[model samples]
Every structure is written in structure tokens, then in C-alpha cells.
Target: MRRVVIIGAGLTGLSAAYHLRQLRVEADVLERETRPGGACRTTSRNGFHFDLTGHLLHLARPESQKLLREIGIRNALRSHRRRAGIALAGCVTPYPIQINTYRLPREIRRDCLLGFIEAHLGKADSDTQPRNFLEWVLSRFGDGFARHFFIPYNRKLYCTDPAELTTEWVGRYVPRPDLADVVDGSLGLYRKRVGYNATFLYPREGGIQLLADAIAATFPPVRLSCAVRSLHLGAKEAVLESGEVVPWDALVMTAPLSHLAAMTADLPAAGRAAAARLRAVAVVNLNLGVRGPAPRREHWLYVPEERFPFYRVGIPSNHGAVAPPGCHTLSVEVSLPAGAATASGLRERCLEGLMELGLLRDAADVVTVDEVHLDPAYVIFDAARPEAVSTLRDAYRAAGVALAGRWAEWKYSTMEDALWDGATVARRLAG
Candidate 1:
């Protein structure tokens, strides 16, 4: 029997454990936090339940949906009526940008429509490699749409200019609407919603934590509150915190690559240098308990203006039954570059933004505020990112340590992607 230790206990860690149990592999999970879910935990305060962020389960592939069903939580899944819009120049536009062109000012709308037509007329004969996120957005949606929506939204969400980021991160994360859909949308004739995230699933009772907890429960050997400080990677052994050394033929690490580098202090200087160059965006989630139901029609609202500190706002009450009746909850998500700002400052800015946007109306509408900071929430895919990530990954592989999850893989991934990565790690270990 092979003994495996999984770190972090997030959706990825729990999924890995669950899959390992299915294979009858011996495994133990070590989580630094007292709870299992890392960023997906749900907490209740003063009769209001709040997730770290409003997590809506939207699977990119059928295999992911199948896995959800296999976990038996599928029966508990309820799909939300997709209600989302982008707040631009004090007006709410239908989300996915293309479907709601009527919300924009007449001139702006005409320009956008014309740009779309021109882009189609000048369509390339062959696929041109996008130099950056800006080029990618323009190439896909034209300059008008890119400047009006994609650029501002992405800048707020990633805390960096789109031009500084790579285009590889755009795959599946952003949807490209066809010319017919764009025309129909412009003519107010499009009936179908635009993107894959139009409708998403959530658990009936516990929110997304249900999925993580269920997976963790399947593997009983998980150790909680065990923070891994360092790793002593040898030819046939690995050691964790509390001086407990576990001998293993192989090791798998799902922790952030930066943390992994710190763990393997004995690695070559070049490897450590490459790891240091890898940058990540930290996220501050301000969960606010509000009076009554949500004021908007959508599950989420995107802020593309500089007036708002948060790039996106999610109302759990709009999507799931987790929030208390007569009381709604909003998760204000602000992405900050690492060391860019403090959580308190960011929270205050978000509140101010909410006031300016008229979402909060008055200070009295706020019942409670719970703040959570998720470090390394986004991996910045810059020109140097691929090289840095590859070097670190190769170094870890050479040292016999497995890497998985968003930060581990250094990809801008959805929750489904993280779960898939975890399951893949488990299969490799099981085999």
C-alpha cells in the first residue's frame, strides 16, 4: 500500500482524497486550517450564511458534471436563473457584453455595432497569434467591445493592464460570440443567453463547502490544523511539520508554487529564483449582509468603472438558499497585486464604491460585514510566467514532488478545473 499525503484540503485536496479512496489507496490529508475547505468555506454570522465568494458551479466539460453526479451531490444541485449585468456609465448592461448592447448610450452602441461589423468584414484568413490580452480581446470582440468592457473589467479583476498579461489565459475563460449573435444582439433579436456561465449549479443547503466536505469525509485519515512548514525531499522520504517524518516512494504537493519553493530550500538557486519571479493576485472578499432581497436581477454585477473598487459583486441570495430570508448577502471581490494594499483599506474602498454605485443606498442597509483575504487567488500569466512556472514545475518533478491546483499549475482556472487537477493527481498516485 502506498501512503500519500495531500496538502491544503481545498476542493483540489478533497477531490484528490476522494478519488484516492475510490482506488483504495492509503492517504492522509494535512490542512493548515481547522476546516477542510480552503477558499470555499461557508460561514454563518447573525443568521446570515456567506461563502468566501459566491461560488457557482459551471462545468466546462461533461466529465466534470459526471464527477459531480458521481459524488452524489448532483441530486442536491439546483440551477440558478442567470441574472447578470455589467454596470457601465451608471447603466446596467446584460452580461457577456454582446447580448446587451441596448444598455449603452446610442452613440457608443452604434460605434460598437459598427466596429463588430468592420471586424467581421476584415476577418483574417488565418489565426493570428495574440501578442497580449488586449490584442486577444480586440481580435475576438473588436476594439469598441474590448475597450468598453473587457479591458476595464479585466483590469479591475486582475489588478493589471490586460496588455501586460498573456493570451493563453483567455482560453475558455472568455467566450467569443459569433457574428450572427452579435448582429441579433444589436438588433434586439437574440433570444439565447451568451456564455457557459449563463446558468450554474449550487448546493441546496451548505453552499460549495458541501462538495469539499463530502469529498473529505470519504477519506478519514485527513489531519486538520497541520501546517506544513517545510519539506525534506529525499530519494525515498518526505518530512512535514511537527517533526513527523513520513517515508514515501513519491510525494505530491498541491500547495502554491511559491510555498513549494520555500519548502524545498535545498533546491538549486536557479529554481528558487524562478519561483520568486512568479507573481500572483491576492483577493479580498467582503461579504456583506444586507436587508431584504437583492436589488438587482442578476446573480452577479460587473463594475468596469474606476469608481468601484470591486471588479465583480455576487449576491448569494440571488443564486442559492444559503442566505437568510429578509436578509441578502453580497460578496464584493477586489483583486490586488501582492503587497499592493491592505485588506482593511480595500474593504473601505469597496464600501465607498458600493455607495457611489447606489448599490448600498445608505449605510443602514448593511447588517454585517465579514472580510476574507485569499492570497494567490490569481496567477499572473505574463511573458515570463510560462518560463518561470515551467522551471519550477520541472525542478519539483526532478525532485520527485507532484504539483497540482490553480497556483500549482499557475493557470487561471475555474473550480471545476481545480477539481479535475486534484482527481488527476489521485489517479497518478493510485496507479
Candidate 2:
């Protein structure tokens, strides 16, 4: 029997272990944290439940749906037609601002509509082939939409210049409205939802940790608080903090790729250098349990203007039973470069921004405030990302390590992708 060891009992690691068991292959799961569910875990504070950040499930694959059924969480997860919006130019507009710009201020609306027309009418053969994210946004959505929403929102979210980013991560995440749709949107006639996440599934109660917990229940108990001090790839062994040597025929790493590189004791110089080239932004997730009901009916709002400290704000209470009977939960997300120092009074600034945007009434109404800082929250897909990720992954695989999930694979992805990656890696190792 081949020995298998998985690191970081996140959704990906837990799913990998579960599938491995179904395949009749046993595996050891190690988690640095005392609890499972990485970012999927939820914390309860003063009767309000909060996840690390916004984690909604958008299941498009039959396999993912089937897995949910098998794990007995299919019914526990409820579907929701996304009620999301964008806050800009002193007015809140429906999301995908490309097609829903009618509600925006007159001048902003005019700019967006005219820019779309110009981009569409003056488009050339070269315009269709965007070299970077900036070019892609300019070509596809035009200058007005790009300037108003895409450029500022993404820049604030990714914490990088749009031109420095690549288009590889923008496949279906960014919706492309047609000329008719754009025109209808400008006229406030476009009502069709047009994105991969237009409709999503979230846990009815107990937060997203339910999915992770259910999957873990079907597998062997994961070793909690068992941190891997370093990886001896040459000897095919992992040295735990307690000095326990866990040898494995295959190792599934669901931790950050940068962490993997930093922890490996004998990785080649080129592999380490390639890993170092990978860049990402961190998120400061401020979870608040306010006194009153949510001010907005929309589940979340995208904040694009530089005046706002957060790129996005979400009302988690709108989607699930995460809040108390009378109170609502707010999930505010601010992005910064990975390892950057979090500024003092940032939380105060976020509250002020929320109030300024009319999302909150008074800071004194706040009950509980929780903050979570996630490093490498979003992987930066730059021009060199493809070659760098490929080189590192190939090198690690050759050394008996398989990277899984968003952080390990080093890309932008959702919860469903995590499950898919886990099961895929498990099947490959089982074979």
C-alpha cells in the first residue's frame, strides 16, 4: 500500500481525503490550525456568526453537485439569485454596471454608454486581442465602463495596476454584455442576469464550515494542530513541529504555494526563485454584527471609488441565518499587498466609509467587531504567472508533492473549484 499524506485540512484537503477513502486508499491529514476549514471556518461572536470572508458556492459541475449530495449537505445549501450591486458616483446601481448603468448619474451614464459605442464601432482586429487586463477591459467593455467600474474596482480589489495583471483569470468571472444588452442596460431595460455567479448556493445555517465538516466526517480524523515544520522532499518525508517524521509515497499540499516553497528544505534554487516570483494581495476582512436590520436589501455592494477603504461590502445576514434575530452582519473587505502593514485606525475608516455610503446608520449601534487578515487572499495573475506557476508545479510534482486548491495552485477560484481540485488530485493519486 502506498502511503499518502495531505497538508492543511482545508476544503481541498478534506475533500481529497474523503475521495481517497472512497477509492479505498488511506491518507493522513495534517492541519496547522486546531480547527478545520481554513478560510471556510465560521466564528460566533455575541450571537453573530462570521466567516473569514464571503464564501458562496457557485456549483456548475454535476460532479460538485453529486459530491454535495453524497456528503449530505445538498439540502442544507440553499440557492439564491444574486442580489448584488455597485456603489459609485453617489448612487447604487445593479451589478455588471456595463448593462445596468441607467441608474447611475446622468454624466457617468453618458460616459459609459458612449464609451461602449465607441469601443464597439471603432474596434479593429488588433483590439480583439487584448495583451493585458487593462486592454481587455478597454476593448471588451470600453473606456467608460472600464474607468467607472472595472478599472477602479479591480485595482482596489487586486491592489495592482490593471496593466500589470493578466487576462487568464478573467474568463467567466467578468461578464461581457452584448451591444443590445449594453444598450438595454443604459435604458434600464436589461433585467437578465449575465454571469457565472448570477445564482449561487450558500449554507442555510451554520456558515460554510458545514460543508467542510460533513466531508471530514466521512474520512479519518485529521491531525489537528499538527504543523509541518519543514518538508524534506529529497527524502520524501515531512517533519512535523513535534519532530514526527511522516513519510509518504505522495503528498498533497493545500497550503499556499509560497509557504510550500519556503518550508521545503531541499528545493532547487530555480524552483524557489520561481515560487518567489508569484505575487498576491492580502485581504483585511472586517466582520461586524450591527444593532439593526441591514440597511440595504442587496446582498453585497462593490465599492470602486478611492474614497472608500473597502473594495466590497456584504450583508451576510441577507443570504443566511448568520446573524441574531434583530441584528445583521456586515462583511467588509479591504485589499493590500501581501505582507503589507495594516494601517492604524483602518477599522474606524471602514466604518466611516460604510456610513458615508449609507450602509450604516451609526457606529454606536455596532455590537461586535471581528477582524481577520488573510495573506495571499488573491493570487496576482501577472504576465509571468503562467510560466512561473508551471515551473514550480512541475518541479514540486517531480518531488512527490501535488498542489491543490486556490492557494496551492496559485490562482483566483471559488469554493466549488476547491472541491473539484481536491477530488481530481485524489483520483490521480489513487490511480
Candidate 3:
């Protein structure tokens, strides 16, 4: 294909451009925002940097880590052992909640451990698929673990019942402890961490956005603030909001599948229906730069209890000097319905939640707070999602469009996943 065009300047699009250029293939990137990074961008205010979300650089794949080093963040990245926790029973306990139940009350610990053991021994080698996320958890983790942490925490994160979600996206992101590991962890005797992100890397400075910045540097200026209004598959053209039509022989779309489907001119009816049925969770970040002790005591915490509106809260200062010395920056995520607007007290509610959790001794401890809205954050993997997304993907291939990135693929993915997706598509297209 000639005259290639990549849509969205997020890490995926940038990676595609970088790889294509290395292959001596010229490609242009278009972004709706003025900045390059999408959710990966960071904001600096009064010497404190607030990452837009809980953007941790967990290098699960060696190839992805090597690429980051090649992008010039090798020396700048600092590795930190994960010190995350879960809030339950009015106390903060070590993370991988199922395994770390020793801190719970006597009855709770017994129930969790017994249930886990029963599941471990009786978990048959059947081939029947779990109908939903709840069933998957119940079958694998049993009642105690499911009721206590898995269900509540996920419900808070997705803002929906777990039974509504499909089990397709769990892949390797969630930590699944074995019988030995679970027994040891629950007894406070587990020495080894058992999770996908037991340890992660972050830039020594500039928040998590540096990874996106470094990748963006290798590509030419992206057409920023230029939202695509329509795509003509027949003519191989993308129509911009400014009424400019750009022609291309091939296209890489990193925008949300719904947006792409809406913009495309002659997409099949099934594709349109699939896009319309897709579900996602909206998220808002109450980013606070405070004068109190940094939330550094623990890197991040998952709030499984329903008393708080936020599902997760992360302190960037815990990983590095993201804030001024002795000061801390908090990034809190509140999940909402997809496409729903107007969270009236989301910011205030988040601050109050921090106060209740004792993270903030009082409101006076706060210095500055900013609310950043990720309109469509986590794509919910409901049972209908896979089929819907498949219909869209099949249509996309027919229309000669390559999908890249988490949102484009409509899956819950990591930064490494995005980078690798771009590289894979670029390699195939280059040949």
C-alpha cells in the first residue's frame, strides 16, 4: 500500500509511525488532541506532575521493555517493587487480596482459606467456558474470595455487575495464585509476590508521560486537533472536521471502535450495530498535589469497599519524585457509565473518600486538585462485546483498515500491548 495514514497519536500510532519510518515507509499521524499522548499525558502544576490515570509501566514482555530502552528511557527509568494494597473490613491489607487474607478477621480468614482450598482441590479439568466474570471467579476462586474482593472491587471498577461482563479480557492481567502460594500468603508467610505487575518501571521524572514523549520525538509532527469526521473506504480518504479530505492507500486507526464505525461511510449494518452495543466504563481522575505525607507509604491502593466512590487511588510520588520533595500527588479513578456526563460531586466525593481513608488528615492538607475526565476509560467485556467487536474487525479488514491500540481493539490492555500491536501491524504492512 502507498500513502499510508495513521489515526490517533497515542503510543500505538506513534509506534506504528516509528517502525514504518525505520522500514523506509513514509506515514502521517493524525490526532484529535493538541498533545501527542492520549491518557498517557501528564500535567505539571506548581512543580507537581499528575499522571492522567494510574499509568504504570509494567514490562511484562522483554521485547516491549527492550523497545522502551531503545526509545531512550533506559537510563531515566527507575524500578520500584510494587507496594499496593486493598481496602477491606475497615483496614488496608496487602494486595492480591485473595492470597493476603491473613490480615482479615479470624472468621474471614478461615472462610477465604477454606473456600480457596476447596476450589483448588475440586477445580475439575472441564472444558465448559465460564458464562461471565462472576462465574469465572466463583469457579476458580470460590465463594469467599469472590464475595469479599473480586466481585466488589471489579464492580466498583466497572460500575456494573460482574455478571454482565465476559471473561475474555482477563488473559494474564489478573494474578492467579496457586494452592501453595495462596496458603502461604494467607498465613503471612508468602515471601514472593505473585502478580503480573509485582515490580514496574517508571521514568525518574516527568511522570509516566515520558514514555509517550520519547516515542513521539522519533516521529514527525502529528496533525493535532484535527478530528476525523468521516472515512470513505471506497475512495481511501479521511474527511477532517475542517473539511479537508486526505487520501490514503492504507490506514491505521487507533481511535475507539465506536468512533471509527460512526465515521466510516458504507460499513455493514452488523458492524454499526456491533459498535452501538459495545460497552465501556468512563473514568474521572481527582488528581491532588498535597502538602501531607506522600501517599508513598504504599504506591497505590484498590478500594473494594463500597463506602468510597473511587475504585483505585495511586500516588505518583511513591514511584519517583513526581511531586516536590515531601509533597505527594494523588491520582484517583472514579468509574462511571459509558458516555454518561455530569458527575456533580465526583471531585469532592473523592477528596472526602481520601479523608475517610485517613490518607488526608483533613481538607486543609490539600494544596491543589485537578479533575481530569477520561470519557471512555475501560472497555467492559460484556458477553456481547466479543461478537460485536469481531463483526467490526471483520468489516475493517474488508475496508483495508488496520486497528491498533487498546481503544481501537476494544480490549483492556497495557502500554506494552499498545506498543507491540503497532509494531506487529507495521511489520505486516511493510512487507
Candidate 4:
């Protein structure tokens, strides 16, 4: 029996433990937090329940479906009604922005439609590679869509210009509509919802955290409040935070690659330098409880206006009975570059914007507000990201350490992708 140690106890760590147990492998999980589910945890305050951020499960692969079923929460899953919108130009437009371009003013809509037509006619050959996110959006959806929605939304979420990011990260996350489809949708000739996230599933009782908690429960011997201050990977021993040392044949680490690099004092200078180049974004979640029935809609609302500090908002009561009756709870998500500003300032800006957007009628309606700041929530994928990630990966492999999860892999992945990565890594270790 091989003894394995898993760190973090987030979705990725917990999933790895669950799969390892299923395969009858001996394992122990160490989590710095008292509870499991790093970003997936949900908390209740004054009769309101809030997830760290609104997470919806929308797996497009059969393998993901199998993993969900294996976790025993398959029956509890329910798809939300397809309802989402974007706040643009003081009006709410249906999500996918392209499908609802017709809702714009006549002049603006005409400009967008004409641009789409012209770009479609002069389409570049498929063989040409898009140089940046902006180019990718224009190449796929045309200049109209890029200028109207993609550019602004990407800026809000990424906190960087789209031209600075790479396009290989855009596939499957962004939908590309044919010229006929765009024209028809804009002209009301025809319409369709296209994207992996169009429909999503959530737990009926607890929020998405239920899935992570369930995975954690499967591993009974998990160590809580155990932080990994440093790791000394010797020829046959591993040292942990409490001055305790444990001998091991192999190690699998799920900590952020940047943090891992900082811990390895013996790592080559070149490896350390490459790790410094990897950048991450911070996310702040402002969970608010309002007095009202659930919002008229279930899907999240994307805010694209410069006036709003939040990029998106998710209503929990709309999901089901998770939120208290007659009280609406929402998660307002704001993405910022690391160390952009203080949390208080960001919270104030978000509240003002919410009031202006009518999401909050007034300050009086806000029953409670809980702010959560998550660092390294997103990895900025630029042209250099591939090289940076590859360099770190090779260095870790050489040290007999394996990396997993979004931070470890340094890729923008959905919740399903994280779970899949965890399970895959566990299986390989067990075999």
C-alpha cells in the first residue's frame, strides 16, 4: 500500500482523495483552512446562504458526467432555466450579447449588423492564427461582436487589454456564430443559444460546495489547519510545516506553482525566474442579501458598463431552496489584478454600482454583505504562458513532484476541468 499526501483540500485535492480511496490507495489530505472547498465553500449569515462565488456545473464531456455520477450527487443536480442578460448602454440585453444585439438602438444595431456582414464577406482563411484575444474574437464573431461586447467584458474580467492576451485559451469558452446566424439573430430571423455554459447544474440543497464537501467526507483522515510553509524534497524524505518529517517515495503537490517555486530553495535560478513571470488575477465576491422574492430571472447577469465595479452577479434564491424564503441572496463577482486596491474601496464601488443598476433599490435593502478576497483565482494566459508553464512543469517532474489543478496546470479551467484533472492524476498515481 502506497501512502500519498494531498495538499490544499480544494475541489482538486478533495477529488483526488475521493478517487484514490475508490481505488483502495492509502492517502492523507492536508488543508490549511478549517474547512474543505477552497473557492467552492458556502456560508450562511443572518438567514442567507452564499457561495464564495456563483459556480454552475456545465460539463460538456461524458467523462465528467461519469465522475459526477460516481460522486453520488447526480440525482441532486438540476439545470437552471436559460435566463441571463448583459447590462449595456443602460439597458439589459440577453446574454451572448450577439443574440440580443437587435435589442440595441436602431442606429447602433445597424452599425453592428453591417459590420458583421462585411467581416463575414471578407473572412480570413481559417489557417491564419489569431495574434491575440481581440483578433480571435474578430476572427470568429467579427468586428461588431468584438467591439460591442467581447472587448469590454474581457477587459472587466481580465483587468487587461484583450490584445495583451493569447487566443488559444478562447476555444470552447467563447462561441462563434456563422454570419447567417448572426444576421438572422440580429434581424429576428432566427435565434439559438450556443455555448457550453448555456445550461448548468447546481446542488438542490447546499450550493456547489456540497460537491466538494462530499468529496472531503470520503477521506476521513484529512488534516485541517495544516499549512505548507516550505517543502524540502530530499532523496527520500519530505518536510512539512510543523517541523515534522515524513519519508516518501513520490510526492504530488497541488499548491500554486508560484508558491511552490518560492518554497524550493534548491531550485535552479532559471527555474525561479520563469516562475516569477507567471501572473494571476484576484477575485472579490460581495455576497448580498436583499428583501424580496427571487429575482424575476434565474441566470446570472453580466455587467459590462464601466460604471459597475462587478463583472457579474448570481442570484442564489433563483437556484432553488438554498436561500431563505422571501429573501434574495446574490454573489457579485469582481475580478481585479493582484493588489489593485483595498477591499473596502472595492466593496463601496460595487455597492454604488449595484444601486445605480437597480439590483439594489437602496442601501436599506441590503440586509447583509460578506466580502471574500481570493488571490490567484485566475492565471493570465499570454503568449509567454505556455513557455512559463512548461518550464515549471519540467522542473517539478525532475524533482519527482506532480502538479494538478488550475494553478498547478496554469490554465483557465472550469470546475469540471479541475475535477477531471484531480481524478486523472489520482488514477495515474494509483496505477
Candidate 5:
């Protein structure tokens, strides 16, 4: 590639630029925002620090861990034992809910074990593949667990019918307990660790954005506040909002692939419509700086109750001493529907939730409530998502356009996945 242009200076875009420099390929990175880190951004409010959303570095992959060390934040990255839990039916149950059912109420525990036994006996097993996410959950966990956790939690997160979504993306991120694990859990004897993120990593200070900031510092200074307004793929050029025309040998776009069809003048009508149908959940992050001890010592909680407007809560203070002396912090994630209602009322909703959940003692203890909303936080996998994503990628690739990151790839992924995406694309483009 003679002249490579990377759009969006998020981790992926910055990673691409970093690797390109190693290959002696100088690249220009364009970011519309004033700062570099996209979704991995962190803000300091008073004495509390809050990320864009819940972001923890899982150094599960060797390559990902190596990248961290290379970025010089490895020492700063603190190892955290995952103490995540779920708030269901007014009870705090250990996560995976399968291995930890022993802590649940007797009747609920019985139902969960029996469901697992039935599913394990092959009576509930179906030879046909699961048609949707609900089916997959039911087949592996049965109705008891589904009704209590999976169904409600997913509904809150996706804001869509789980049955309408395909099971393609449910590739074992959630633990599927067998008979032994289920029996032990129900009998109050299970102690096995479950889930892929059993142990994770986070920065000791500066919140999660330290990783993003460290990575960004390695790349050449980015062209900030430069949004791509239009693209002429055939001519290998981009028109920025500032009326500056950027010419390139190859375009590496890290923005949402579906959202790009409108910008590129050469995309076909069918591709554009397919792109339009792609759906994702917008995330509203509410961070509270409190004047007392944290309600719990756990890193975070998966709140599945309907009354609670938030799906997940991250205790940033637990990760490190993010809050000032005599204060604690909590970060909450709330999903919004297609057309979001007015956000003016969301603060009260979140405050009420924290109090109801027994986290906040009184309204007087509240310090600061920082609200940050991220558009298209999660890629909603409907029947159309696969086709839409494929169509978008095929069209872009055919035009010699390179894509990078979770948004551009339109896949359910983690931070490591995003980094890998950028590195892979940069290598391919440079090759």
C-alpha cells in the first residue's frame, strides 16, 4: 500500500497504525472526536473515573497479553479475580448461576437442578440445531434457569425478542453446566469456577482507558476532529467534514460497516438497504460517585431484574482506588431502544435502582452521577445480521476497501478481538 488511510482512531485504528509503522508503512489516522480512544474512553468527574462502558482487559490470549506489555502498561495492569454476580428476584446469586445455584432459595435451586437433570438425560435434547438463542439456552439449561436469568437478562440487554435471534453468536461465551455441576450446585456443594472470564485484568489506575491511551501514544499523532463525510471508493479518496479531501492507496475504516454504505457512492441499492437493517443496542452508562463504602466488594454485577433500568454494573472503584478518599464509585450500563426516550429521567431511574438494590444507603450519599451514552454498543444478531454483515464486507472488499475493529466487522467481540482485527488487517494490507 502506497498511502494507507485509517478511519476512527480507536484501539483498532491505532493498533493498525502502530503495526503499519513497524512495517515502515506510514499511515494517516482520522478521528472525528477530539480525543483518540473511541469506545474505550475514560473521563474523570470530580474524584471518580468512569469508562465509556464496562471495559476490562482479559489477557486470555497470549498475543493480546504481548500487545499489552508492548504498550508499556503491563505493570500498570492489575490482575483481578472475577467476583461477578447476578441480581434476580431480589437475590444476589453467584454468576454462571449454574455452579452457584447452591446459594439460591431452596425451591429455585431445586427447579434449576431438575432442569439440568432433564436436559442432561437427553429427554430435552433435540437432534436439530437450535433455531435461535432461546432454544439454545433451553436445550442446555432448561426452562427453570431460562425463565429466571437468561431470558430476562438478554431481553434487557438486546431490547429484542430472543427467539427471533439466531444462536450463531452464542458460541459458548456462557457456561453450559452438565449434570455433575448442576447437582452439586443445587445441593449446596458446588465450587467449580465457570465462564471464560473467570480471571481478568484491569488497569490499577486511570480506569480502563489507560490501555487505550498507552496504545494511542505509540502511534503517530492522529488527525482528530476529522470525520469522513463521503467516500469515492473507485477513486480511493475520502471527503472529510472539514472539506479536506484525503487521497489514499487503501482505506481502512473502523467505523460501523453498516453505517458506511451511505457514505461510499459506489455501493449498490440492495447493499445499502441490508446495511440499514443492521441493528445494535445503544448503551447509556451512568457513573455515580458516592460518599461511603461500596455496596459490594465484587467487581461488577449482572442485574437481570426488570425494575432495574440497567443490565450490568461495574464497580470501577473495586478495580482500583479510582475514587478519592472517603468515597466509592459505581458504573451502570442501560440499554436503549431504537428511538431512545428522553434521558432526563434516566438519572432518577438509576438512583432509584441503586437504592432498591441496597447499594446506596440514601440519596444524600450521592456525589456525582455521570451519564455517558454509546450508540450501537452491541450488535443485535437477528436473521438479517449475517446477510447484512456479509453483504457489507463483500462490497467493501470488492472495492479494495479494508475494514477493521468490532464495529467495522459487525461481530460480537471483546477488546482483544478488536486489537487482533486491526493487527490482522494491517498485516494483510501491508503484505
Candidate 6:
């Protein structure tokens, strides 16, 4: 029998193990955390269940739905049309502000609409191939929309200048409405949902961890709280934090690519250099349990203004019964460069911003506060990412290491993509 070891035990790792079991193969899943879900884990405080962050499932593929049904979680998830918006200039407008400019201030609406018309009429002269994300936005949505929403919102979320990012990771995530749609939006006539997350599914009660836990139950028990200290690639062995070495013929890695690069012992100098070039941002997630009903009816809101410490805020209770009967939950997200020190008093700043926006009636309404810092929360898709990822992948592949999941591939992705990645890698290993 060929020995196989899967690391991370995230959704991707669990899926890989589950699929491997179906193929009559067995693999040991090692998880450094006490629980299975990586970023998908949820916590309960004062009867309020809070996820690490918002993790809604957008399942576009049939296989994903089939897997959920097979795992008995299909009935647990309920579908919902997204009630999301962008808050700016003291007014709240539906999300994809590109198509819902009608609710924005008159001046901003005029700028966005006129900019779209001008760009549409001059599409022939604009660059067909954009050099960066900034160029792409300008060419597609024009300067007005770029200046108002895309540029500022992305800047706050990615924690970098939009011009510094590449367009490689923008597929399906950003909606590019036609001229007619834009005009309709300017007139408040557009009602159709746009973007990949226009509609999604969430667990009715267990928070997002229910999906992870369900998949994990289909396979052998995962070794929890066992951290991987380093990898001896040539030796096909992984050294645990406790000094135990586990050997395997095939290794599936679903953790962050940066971690993989740091741990591998036999990586070449060029591989190390490539790893050094990879960049990502961290997220300081603040989950709050409020004493009353949710302040906003929308599931979440995007904050483009720089004055707000948080780029986004979510009312988790609006989507599920995660809070007590009379209580609600609030999630605030602040992004920083990976390994960057979180600014002092960030929590207080977030509360102030929320109250300023009227999302929070009073600071005294709070019950419990929990903060989770996730380093490498989002991969910065810069110009050098392609070459860097390719270099690291080639170096690791030579040693029989298979990478799976969003952090492993070092790209933007959803929970569904993670499941597919796991199954695909598992089948390859089984063969």
C-alpha cells in the first residue's frame, strides 16, 4: 500500500480524504488546529455563534451539490438572495454599485453614468489588454466609477494600490454590466442580481463549520492539534512539532503556499526567492454579540471610505439564527499587510465607525467581543504572482507534493473551489 499524508485538514484536505476513501485508498489527515475547519471554523460566545469571517457557499457546480447531499448537509443549508450594499457619502446603495448607482448621491450618480457612456462610446481606442487592475477598471467602467467605488473599495480591502494588482484574479468576481444595464441602474430600473455571490447558501444553525464537519465525518478521523514543523522533501518525511517524523509516498498540502515554501528543506535558492516575492494581506476580524436585534436588514455592507477602520461589516444574524432570540451578531473586517502589526485601538475605531454610520445605536449594546487575526487572509494578485507560483509549484511537484485549496494554489477562490481542488487531487493520488 502506498502511504499518503494530507496536511491542513481544511475543507480541501477533508474532501481529498473522503474521495480517497471512496476509491478504496486510505490517507492520514494532519491538522495543526484543534478543530478541522481552517478558516471555516465557527465559535460560540454567550449563545452567539460567530464564524472566523463570513463564509457563504456559492455552489455553481453540480458535483459540489452532490457532495453536500451525499454528506447529508444538503438539507441543512438554506438558499438566500444576497442583500448586500455599499455605504458611502452618507447613503446606502445596493452592491455592485456599478449597477445600482440610482441610490447614490446625485453628483456621484451623474459621474458614474456619464463615465460609463463616455467609456462605452470610446471602447475602440482603449487598451484591449489591460496592464493592471486599475487599467481594467478604467477601460471597462470608466474613470467616474473607478474613482468612486472600485478604486477606493479595493484599495481598502486589498490594502494596496489598485494599480499594483494584476487582472488575473478578477474573473466572475467583478460584474461588468452592459451600457443598457448601467443606464437602467442609473434610473433605478435594474433589479437583477449580478456577480458570483448574488445568491448563496448558509447553514440554518451550525454556522459554516457544519459543512466542514460533515465532510470530515465521511472519512477516517483526522489527527488534530498536530503541527507540521518542517518537510524533508527528498526523504518523503514530515517532521512534527513534537519531533516525530512521518514518512509518506505522496503528500497533499492544503495549507498556505508561503508556509510550504518556508518548511520544505530541499528547496532551491530560486524557489526560495520566488516564495519571498509572494505577498498577501491579513484580516483582523472582530465579531460582536449585540444585546438587541440587528441594526441593518442587509446581510453585509461594503465601506469604501478610508475614514472607516473596517472595509466591511456584516450582520450575521440577518442570514442565520446564530444569535439568541433577542440578540444579534456583528462582524467587522480590517485588512493589513501580512505580518504587519495591527494598529492599536482598532476595535474601538471600528465601533466608532459603525456608530457614525448608524449601524450601531450605542456602544453599550454590545455583549461579547472576539477578535481573530488571520494572516494571509487574501492573496495579493500582483504582476509577479504567476511566475512566482509557477516556480514554487514546479519545485514542490518534483518532490511528489501536491498542492490543493485556495491558500495552497495562492489565488482567489470560494469554498466550492476548495472542495473541487481536494477531490481532484485525491483522485490523482489514488490512480
Put down candidate 3 lDDT per residue, 311-411, tens digits, no spaces: 98887788877888768888888888877884787677878888888777777878988788886799988878888988999889887899888999999
Q: What is candidate 6's lDDT per residue for 1-431, written digit by digit as tens?
A: 89999999889999999999999999999999999999999988778899999889998998888998999989999999999999989999999888899999999999999999888888877656878999889889998999998999899999999999999899999998999999999999998998889899999995999999998888889999999999998899999999999999999999999999999888889999999999999999999999887888999999999899889999989999899889999999999999999999998899999999999989999989989999899999998899999999998899999999999999999999999999999999988
lDDT of 2 at 390: 91
**What order do candidates take by lDDT, descending?**
6, 2, 3, 5, 1, 4
- Candidate 1 per-residue lDDT over residues 1-431, each given as its tens digit: 55677777888888888887788876777888878888788888888778888788887688877777777778888877688888888778777777568777877677678777777766666467778988877777887887788888888788888999888876666777788888777776777865668778888775688878767766685788788877766544556577776665566677888878877747778888898888888888889999876777678888888767788888787767766778777889888887566655666677778878767766678989988888888888899988888888888788667888987787777788778888899898777
Looking at model 6, the pairs that clash are: none
Candidate no. 6 TM-score: 0.99
Q: Which lDDT tens digits does candidate 2 get at residues 1-431? A: 78999999999999899989999999999999988999899888789889999888888898888988998989999999999999998899999898899889999989888898888877764535788999988888789999988889899999999999989988888888789999999899998888988989889986888888899899879999999999998899999999999998899999999989999999899998898899999999999999988999999999999889999999999999998899999999999999999999999999999999999999998999999999989999998889889998998999989999999999989888888899999999988
**Which digits, one per residue and each the tens of the lDDT, describe model 5 over residues 153-214?**
99999998889778877774888767887887776677767677888888787787787778
TM-score, every prediction: 0.94, 0.98, 0.96, 0.94, 0.96, 0.99
Worst 10 residues of 1 by lDDT: 232-241
The clash numbers for all candidates, in the given order, read: 1, 0, 0, 0, 0, 0
Task: Give the RMSD in angstroms, all C-alphas superposed, for model 3.
Answer: 1.7
- Model 6: lowest-lDDT 10 consecutive positions: 121-130
Give candidate 1's error at residue 250 in angstroms. Answer: 2.2
Model 4: CA > 4 A from native: 124-128, 235-238
Predicted structure 6: clash tally: 0
Query: What would the TM-score be for candidate 5 when compared with the true structure?
Result: 0.96
Error of 4 at 270 (Å): 1.7
Best by TM-score: 6
Q: In lDDT terms, how accurate is model 4? A: 0.77
